[model samples]
Target: MIGNKAVYAGWKAAGMPDMLNGDDHFAYIVGYSDKTVHPQNGITRVAVATIFFRLLTDKVRDANSTLTNNYSDISRGIWYDHAVSTLSKMGIVKGDSHGRFGPNAPITCAEAMTLIDRVLNRLPESRDDLLNGMIQWSDNTDTSKWYYLVVQEAANSHYDDIKSDHHEKWTKLRDTRDWTQVEK
Candidate 1:
């Protein structure tokens, strides 16, 4: 977002609290929890895996990435570290310059769009496979709202069960032109 107000409106339209302003953007993802989940130090391994599994669908045939093993070694730092291993294994996320994914850092809207795009790209593609995926989870130069494009793609692809919370943002964004800020 170019300005704080636009970013604030976009997040608010994306079903976030009005109080979450820029630099405070990440509060939308973690602030909802009564307690803060530290990406490297505060989060649990199992907690991250569970979130990844929820994004899986019928045709996502990645057995190795299923993460059904003893993840005891990874309870190291931050909540997103767990997400990195599985998501990276699934070819969805990557880390830092030294190969470290800052799981605790606040992600910008553009980066979030690209991340969702990467995950969607990994899914198996087949004709009429409704359960395969949906929304425009790509970083199209023309996609007015990259976030909504991903959400809509998930919906269109029939990605089994995204929490209704994210979907509700789509409705509000469609109803209001609040997402334009991200475009600017």
Candidate 2:
């Protein structure tokens, strides 16, 4: 698994504008109170929520900001509260069967892929359709796995399409100066 610092550097190199200034800016990832991003540690669910929420346009966020959920673990004024609420409203994130959001839990691969699919609007209408397109990784052949179809869909996405989509978002952010400046 990649670390937070590497992910941040990669995104910056890929034309994602820095958004790590003060309170006016929205950082996609942030370090813990110890002033370290824990480069080798797995990312938590709340961190993922914050990242995706920062990646969203302000218009979308504003539209969904008032929406709320019933996750027992989420308090109203936490750092990730708004992000979690917005994502839950958009159906990009969900709590467990016990109605717990598990904010600090290390997110699983399947859960991450599901969030990606939801945010990208790439979820297939039927999992059966993706079986034929599946890539045959030795450990990934299990059709019953919940992530099977989403993983296959990601694997099958054309390189050009992915590049184009990323470029489009980058260009939009750049043009609008929507992102905050990183502190030097």
Candidate 3:
């Protein structure tokens, strides 16, 4: 079975408070509790999804703190609740047509790319050039596919308009060169 050390390290690196020692809620909120343990070898998809959302929005929060149960699949008090709610409110992510977030389901590559694109677009200093560059995926560019345009924009670099903004400052965490080389 995989140990908890990696999750602990990730939690700390994401600026989460170091309260995993004895706080059950903290561990669960950050997805590091004993319940996250996987007997086979790896963490569950829900656990990873919770962690991913936490890492992405650790430095941000919705002031309202309203409980928007947008997904029937995600219950209240789960590790990913607030993060998912906030992201959903910001339109960075969305549930399925049937109103299911499927928190436990593994995200497909198309979904991952679409999420990345949407987040980048939400950034104040979005790299439109990089996003509109090219079509990398050979098979998934159908306009009907939800991820078609997102993948195309994520793989291309058509604009170079640069400006200063909070998103620009935040995106500095990852170098621009990396986006230029996004996988097809």
Top lDDT hit: 2
Q: How many backbone clashes does candidate 2 have?
A: 0
Whose TM-score is higher: candidate 2's or candidate 3's? 2
Candidate 1: tens digits of C-alpha lDDT, residues 1-184:
4434322212224532221132322222343365755645433333443354444542343453433222333444544444455566765554445654544456655455445445434122222222322334345425344344443443232223333332221111123343466566
Error of 1 at 25 (Å): 26
lDDT of 3 by residue, 91-165 (tens): 666789999988867666556655655544423232232333344566855556666555555444343333454
Q: Total clashes, candidate 1?
A: 18
Task: Show where candidate 1 strays beyond 4 Å.
Answer: 2-53, 58-62, 66-82, 122-184
Model 2 agreement with the true structure over 61-173: per-residue lDDT tens digits: 78788436799999988878999998898788999889999999999867877776666555654443443433466666777877776665544532212233332111111
Better of 2 and 3 by lDDT: 2
TM-score per candidate: 0.35, 0.66, 0.54
- Evaluated at residue 147, the lDDT of candidate 1 is 42
Q: What overall lDDT goes with each candidate model?
A: 0.40, 0.64, 0.49
Point out where model 3 deviates above 4 Å: 1-31, 34-49, 56-59, 122-133, 160-184
The candidate with the higher lDDT, 1 or 3, is 3
